[model samples]
Target: MNDHLVILIRSFSAFFILMIIGRILGKQTLSNMNFHEFVTAVILGAMAANFAFNEKIEVIHLLIALSVFTITSYVLAKLFLKFRSFKMWTEGTPTVLIEGGLILEDNLKKNNMTLDSLNQQLREKDIFNVEEVEYALLEINGKLSAQKKKELQAVTLKDLQLNAGNAPQFPIELVIDGQLLHGNLDSNHISESWMNSQLKARGKKLEDVFYAVKGSNGQLYVDDYKDNIQHPIDME
Candidate 1:
């Protein structure tokens, strides 16, 4: 066999083996992997690569290493789920960065995060001013969770004491990419005739509409394939 063909076969075989192992281990390894999980994934990848390219290393040895790493990760996940203390130890606890509009500088230093970084994170959450925050926590996943001060928060229906009717339903997509979503219409208690009527009212045909949605407010929103620019051109 050609050297290139042998390499290709080895690489393809390693890929399939990894896929099978991934399926057995489940999605825990794929998403939101914590510190231990991340380390395990790195080590597994390195071992798999060695097995794929290195002719001196036996495939069975690499397989055993991969199996051990995966099984250990799976067991750790199970332990985290069952024991809260273990979970906290492995994943770490949420650090209180801001409390009562005051920044916890010590905690920030402990977490190796700078004040500028915290401010940047705050801005990402649409919070421009740190004084407007009542509480802010640095979650284990390195994400910031903030609570705005009562005065800084947006006005809610409850605050106004308005008698708002039943909760509005989510907008139901009727058509997407000129394809009618029959299942959505059926689930939303809408009929094909009513949908057609809506299109007719807008001087649009079903096939001509690029997208259509029935909003929670009983409004039919439609978009066409072509842009209808109505702005006046400035020739100057």
Candidate 2:
């Protein structure tokens, strides 16, 4: 066999095999690319590259290595979900970097993070001063999550002494895509008669609504199927 032809065949084979293994491992691993996933991705990429170019290595051996690693990754994910101790062992717990506006020097040392790095991360989150942070945690994914002190937090309607009524029926989907959810309506103690009355008041029927929800403000919000817009600007 020609060397070029052998290389072409092996490249395609490695490509397709990687794709198959990726699908089996699931989208969460690929999309999030967590700790375990990061290691697996690097190893798989190296193995695939060697499989494509390293003619000295047998194809069967490469396939077996890929399969073993893929299986290990898939099983570990499942085990992590069901077993807390196993998960903690593989992926260490979140470390508290700051508490009550005080940076924990010891915790920072444990994470091998310096004051400059911690400050940099906080600055990335728009916190220029560490004193503004009520709590900060170093997540397993190497991301820093911080909570602002009460005084530093954004003021809402409640803080302004304005009456912003709560939405109990919030997220209640009364009608979705011209289809009314009978179960949601019944569960919420709402009736079809009330829904019909609201539609009638708007001079619209059930079919006219693309989406409708009982908002958090205890108000009926409805969207038309046909927006009847001559010029609509799409953000995308």
Candidate 3:
């Protein structure tokens, strides 16, 4: 078989197989995926991509591999639904961060959560006062669910009758996946030379950066592709 022809055939096959697999798997959108679902989707995509491009691997082998993994994932999902303990084990239970307007220091420390991070999440929800939050939970999906104090629930910005001096500014991404976002940089009046100097100071090149964003505080937060963490958490 011609190599190009073989590649084209494999690509088509992979595409159709993925469509079938997705239908079998049901609705799991990228926006609201849990950790296990994210892992499963990534692995399946990698496998399919490898199968499509790597001609050394036989077509039948790829089919068998996909079938095995698909069945395994399906079985595990069914198990997760059937047993409460199993579901909790696979997908962690919600963590309580605040109770009765008081921060739970012990719970925060155990989850490796900082006050700054908690405050940031709260700020995103337009909540400025921790005392106003009667209860706050860190959901399993990494979303913050907070309830305001009964007295504060009806209070509005109009009632305060105070000038909130400055509005919060969202962070702008200057670089993502080693690609420079030209518009973001231009809007911020950030020069490439300055960005290069910043990267050099950190002993990193542009290609080494996974994400680089200018924060509301006017600080350039650069995260590199290599996460040199001594202990990385993995549920599975």
Candidate 4:
């Protein structure tokens, strides 16, 4: 066999094998891309790359490496979930960067955060001034969550002292994709007759809707014909 051919074969084999292994590792490893997970992925890629174009690489060796990586990740995740300290050690805990309108500069520095970065994060939360912030924490996933001081918080309708009473029922769809969700409508004493009436009012029929669901408050939300349009129910 030509040397080039051998190398190409190895590269293709390694690429496919690694891709499958990575898929099996699951989305948690990629989406959040935590520090440890990131490092593990890099290490796995390095291992695969080293053998990608190597003529001497064997499928068995690839399988063994992939197996070890998968098992180790599975074990670590299980252990982390089972124990509090282990979870903290592996994923770390959220750090309080601000409390009571005061900046915890020491905590920020400990987390390798800069004043500028802190300001940027705070700004993202719409807290331009540090004084408006009551508490801010650096979550383990590297996201910042902030709470505004009671007085600084945005006032809702309730806060304005509105005495608006009970919220009305919103219609819920009990069918989608030609499948009837009997459970959603059965308990409400709603049937095909009620559904037809509801659909006729909106110039639609049950079959015309792509998807529909009844929300907790008995409201119906619907997406008809999948034009990416959403219709909210107003039950007066």
| Candidate lDDT (C-alpha), each | 0.82, 0.85, 0.80, 0.74
How would you encode candidate 3's per-residue C-alpha lDDT over 1-236 as one tens digit per residue? Answer: 89899889888888899888877876643455676777778888998899888988887888888888888777777876556467778889788798767899999998889999999999998999788887888987788998776556675776366344433234677887687878768986889888889889988999999889877445689988789998999653
Better of 1 and 4 by lDDT: 1
Between prediction 1 and prediction 3, the one with superior lDDT is 1
- Residue 72 local lDDT, model 4: 83
Candidate 2 vs 3: which has more lDDT: 2
TM-score of each: 0.61, 0.62, 0.56, 0.57
What C-alpha lDDT, on a 0 to 100 scale, does residue 83 get in candidate 3?
67
Two-way lDDT contest, 1 vs 2, winner: 2
Q: Best to worst by lDDT, what's the order? A: 2, 1, 3, 4
Report the C-alpha lDDT of model 1 over 106-221, residue by residue, as the tens digit: 99999999999999999999989899988889987788999887666687776466434534334678987677888888977899999998899889898898889977456789
Q: What is the Cα-based lDDT of residue 129 in candidate 4?
A: 91
Misplaced by over 4 Å in model 2 are 158-236
Question: Which parts of model 4 have CA positions greater than 4 angstroms off?
Answer: 1-12, 123-128, 150-236
- What's the C-alpha lDDT at position 87 in model 2? 83
